[model samples]
Target: MSVLIQYYNDFISRSADPRVKQWVFMDNPLPTLAIIAVYLLLVLKILPLYMKNRKPFNLTRIIRLYNIFQVVACILLIYMYLTAGWIQGEYSIGCAPVDWSNKPNALRMVGTFYWLYCLKGVELVETIFFALRKKFNQISGLHVYHHSSTFFLTWIGCKFVGGGMASVPSMLNSFIHVLMYTYYYMSSLGPEWQKKLRPWKPRLTICQMIQFTILIIHSLSAFHPECDIPKYFMLLYLPNLVLIFKMFYDFYKDSYKSKSASLNHHQREKKIS
Candidate 1:
């Protein structure tokens, strides 16, 4: 394990952008890991106990505002990514690489990726909101891990590979969130609007699953020795994307497929009775 740790550190050091070396959390992941640990501890253990005997907070207005903010943030990111990296097809789907220099366009690309890292911190409020509402069921392992890992991995992206192909996943993720938070915003309006919007929910999950698939494919392509993207980053991303895809697939199966099957079974039984 220690040998592996040293190799991993060496890999990151080789790939990291020299320009951003001094940024917080850019030099190492230990600080980010510490923050995630505290957040998990609070949400999963301490806070739940504190809220156990207390009334759940009615945070509908707060949730609505958060959803709106997320939608706006995602939209802005999409625009920034377009202008910085992908507009006019500047970045090919599978082959954009880190711009190691400090030109203006390159700096825009780097800043956009770093901005995503910052947003991941804000997204932590998602878990906290669930906790505040006493919606413990929503705070699953998948939820916490997704929030935590994105923060860490994106930090790695911004710190090491901040241009070219680095922007792909962030752009895709922002696009997905635009749809996702719009749905959330509608649902927060109450069951009436939620019912009208219900049809879009599974579509959102499907989009998320597809987003993971695309990331896996794009990153996997970078593993070819000829690609300018670093081999180690692709190596790290491929497995991680596979894991996220599996998790989301399982979620879709349980949340949508299983529920549909159970509902059909109940309908058949009722007819028989």
Candidate 2:
């Protein structure tokens, strides 16, 4: 383990810019991981055990506010990314390498990247809300894993490759999340509207799968001999995205198929009667 840490330190030191130290939490990785660890523990173990015999708390107002906040934050980040370098006049469509120097635009982009990481942490509340509401069944492995992996993954991107090609996926994901949070925001309205919004939820997952597919391709393109995007960052992002895609797709298939089958069985029984 010490040998592995030494290797990662050597690589990150050489691969990352000195300017990375300027960002909050960039100098120390452990605290971020620890926060995520505590989050997982609370959601999976401590909270559930505590909430077991209690009445579920209604988090209607809080959840709705959270959804709106995420959407607004994502929109702000998207706009900043476009102006900072992601737009046509500013950055190439192919790949943008890390801005090792701390120019103003680079600093803004880096700050937004950090903000995105923090937002991922805040999004963990989604699962916690479920636990609070006693929707424990919704807190599946995929749900927990997705929330867990994103914090570390985005931190890696910011710490090592802040204002570069990786931000593309970050931007794309923000766009999807705008719609996603919008769905959640509407669903938080009430059961009547929530049922109306259920049809849109699957579309959100499909969008997520598509985002992962594009992200995998984008990360792989960095490996082209001409591109300088770090293999280390790609190493962190690509495999995890592939796993995410599979998990989401499998859940979608199983869910949709079961619903269809049950509906068909019920219809056939009605016809028989």
What is the alpha-carbon lDDT for the whole of candidate 2? 0.85
Per-residue lDDT of candidate 1, residues 146-253 (tens digit): 899888888888887888887888888998998898889888888899899988888899999989887877777787778888777777778888988898999999
**lDDT values for all models:** 0.85, 0.85
Give the residue spans of candidate 2 off by over 4 A.
Answer: 1-5, 268-273
For model 2, residues 1-273, the per-residue Cα lDDT tens digits are 999999988987777656667667788688789988899899989999999899999899988888889999999989988888666455665677877666878887877888898899888888989999999989999999999899888888778888778778889999999999899899878899989988877788888989888888777778888887777778778889999999999998888767878999999999999
Q: Compute each candidate's TM-score over C-alphas.
A: 0.93, 0.93
lDDT score of residue 236 within candidate 1: 78
Per-residue error at 137 for model 2, in Å? 0.7
